[model samples]
Target: MRIALIGRPNCGKSTLFNQVAGYKAETGNFHGTTVTYTESKVRVLGEVVDLVDLPGTYVLGGSNPAEKVSHDYLGDHPVDVIINVIDATFLAQSLELTLELLRLDKPVLLAMNMMDEVARLGIKLDGPALEKELGVRIVPVVASKGRGIKALFLEAKRAAEQGILQPRFDDFQDDPYSRHKAALQLSQRFAVQGQRTLSWRDRLDDIFLHPAYGYVALAGVLLLFFQAVYGVGQLIEPPLLALFDSLITNLNTYIDTGNLLGVLLNGVLQGVMAGFAIVLPYLFPFLLGLGFLEDVGYLPRIAFLMDSLMHRIGLHGKAIVPFILGYGCNVPAIMSTRTLEDSRERFIAAALSTLVPCAARLVVVFGLVAFYLGPLYAFGLYLLNLFIIALTGRILTRLLPENTPGMILEMPPYRIPTLRAVANKAWFRIREFIVEAWPTLIFGSAALGLLVFFDIAKYFNWMVRPITWLLDLPAEVGVPLIFGVLRKELSLIMLGQALGNNDYSAVLSNAQLFTFTVFVVFFVPCVATLVMLKRELGSRQMVWVTLITIIIAMGAGLAARIFGLLL
Candidate 1:
């Protein structure tokens, strides 16, 4: 049996998925679609069944990959039943989406989640009445607490065997406005409002979502977040790197360091050191903090805070999701452009999203600027990054004009983050680096070492000399810049090989370090991101984006060099 899970974001869809997703659960792109969904094999009703979790979206009919997946899967796949997860706190909007599912004429088991929060809000929902009204089974569940999940799946299994039930109300029509009104009427009739007591969660939003204090608080939160990452990275990185350097010096005693075999061996070692010492030190803690913020439901509030500012770039607040994801990795950030309805907005969001300083670029900034200079210098680089991104957005928007609609989002209530969930999320990302990126870094580092030993690297250095000259950086940096396009971490790792020194501060001045880091941060994204841009946009736009990035990097690097000189 195949049972699908569907719901809007912040409705506990992910919580429920985690509850039931066995180790077999994995996320992948749907066949013939670019966006992804998760599927798992689970035993339900004494039989192993396929449980699929679709992407979270507010409306299924909207113009996004979610719509295409919904229409394609529901229309063709053997989807026996759908478990529509609903947030009881936002019944009106949740039910409005349920109405969309009913139009499919498929069996739906309504899972009303977050009942605990509902009760605390003093909102009463008549389960039986709503079930009767909608002609579906309604199961009250608190997914995070593991309440009612067993019975919920049991009902889902039963519904799959029973087949489809016709929607009870004829008020459901083709029009969206009609569906909205009907959902509102049904919630009013079935739910009763009680004496509400204000809680800390309510007041928390008042501060987090406040106009004046919110930005101040955001700055404070970010400052602490970066400090924590830098602190942990600082303490661990020095001892580890020193150990590796000592081992390399000892290895030189066994054989000549200039020989071909010795150079290749050392190159591979540097790659491993880069991933373990320089990258993971900063990457893990950054991801941990990001996951905590995400689980605590603070990310969307940032979008709300930045919505007005986002409009200055020809995008809506919803477009900020890609930017947030970009900080983690640019591949997923590009993938997230599907959530934006307008093509122009998607392009603009994707373009700016790449500039958000991903974890790879994060390592570069933290390793060189933050580590050698200070956190304040690294912080200055980030400020410069955002300013450049905003300036680029302003330019792009003027070229392709559009008026984006204001954001309408359901704010999930703040909940204490679970260690298991946050850690697992961070682990998944770190594991991806271990499995996919680490190998590339090791092999690329080795290849770069061979090129430098053979004197062929000078050609690559020659190719990028114009940009290096313009930025007032060392000519040898051109080779690392060329190879860095394959993987951003290579920019720094190979720089050590090209200059014949592992210690950057000993070789390069403060101005050179500042300028080079700026260039790497804004230069062409990694090959993965480039492929994703091509997949998302088109070949033509991909070329345009790549070219535009090279130009931007040159401009930003030169600007940083001039600033360094003036200071």
Candidate 2:
């Protein structure tokens, strides 16, 4: 049997899905975390069942892409049971979607999640009365803590087995407003008020949502995050690189460097070394920190605080969500643009997001620029990238003028991030990068090594000599530039290999190094991001974005060269 989990955004549907499925699907206190559905199979009551976690939506008739995904999935697929999770504190508001689910005539076991919040608020809900009134089984649960989860699933299995149909009601209304009124009446009948007290969540929100101090807190938090990433990376990189170097040296003692087999082995070893030494060290800590912030509900607040600054670029503050996600990967960042209602905003966001330095690009910036020039230069590159993104956003906004809408974001109560959830999310994101990117890096490296071994690199370099001269880089840099389109990290990895060693100081001067970093930072995005841009913005817009980035990258590189000379 196939069961579907549906709920309004941040209503603990994903938390329930994680508990029931026994695998982490990314969960956040903000909307658009689950831009796509995820599926897992689990045994419930000795029966193997397929479970799907759908993207959150407020109503069946909503227009956003996430909503359309939920709506279309339900319409196209045959779901045996629907597990509609709702926030217990906001029963009436959640029931607006609940009522729409009932019209589908499917068996739905309403999981009233976040009951802990309800209890903390001193709200008393009569579960039996709600079940009876709604004509469905109501299981109160605190999904994050795993409270009442087994019982919830048991009831879900029973409902699925029994083929419970939608209850017949003479006064049932089909519209949102009518259903909202009906839900409120039901809540009043079943819910009782008790003495209220402010919890720690309420206390923290006071300072976190403060207009002035909140910005200070945000900056402090971001500072610590980057410091942790850089510090941890520094601690791990030397030992890891040394280990790989030792292994490669020992292996080379037995192999002849003049043969094809030796060439392939060297190429593979270099790629493996780059993946470990350059990418993993930094990527792991970054994702771990990002997952923690997202799970703890701080990311939305960042968006809220940045709304004022974002308006200057003609984007809603909500654009920050995708911008932050872009730091991890640009593909999903572009996909998350669906959360925005306006096509113009989405287009502008997409254009700027693709330019954000992803983990791969960061590997280049830190491993090449920072390792040689110092941390300050690497840090400057990040700031420069942001300035470019803002400038690009401003340009696009003017080119495609539209009225920007006010942001309406729900700030979820802060919760302590669980180590298990954070680890799972971090591993999931890291696994995606390793699985998709490493092979491309390895193949490109091996292919380039072969070209050099066969003495054909000079021809390739000659082909891109004009570009290298334009940027004032060496002819050897041309090979990496050509392959960088496949994967950004390949540029740095191939650069080391192309120059015959990782010691770049021997080949490129400080000015050349800075110029190269600037070019790679703003150049055309990786192939994966390009495909996503094409999908989201169509071929015409994708072409324009591609051209714009190329122009910007060349211009930036030339300007950096001139500045370096003046210095």
For each of the candidates, give the backbone clash count.
0, 0
lDDT per residue (tens digit) for residues 175-221 in model 2? 87898888888788777778988778778867776899888888788
Model 1: per-residue Cα lDDT over 338-364, one tens digit each: 866678888999989888899999999
> Which runs of model 2 end up more than 4 angstroms from their true locations?
22-24, 165-170
Model 2 sits at a Cα RMSD from the real structure of 1.8
lDDT computed for candidate 2: 0.86
Models 1 onward score TM values of 0.92, 0.96
Error of 2 at 166 (Å): 7.5
- Candidate 1 steric clashes: 0
Error of 2 at 366 (Å): 1.1
lDDT of each: 0.83, 0.86
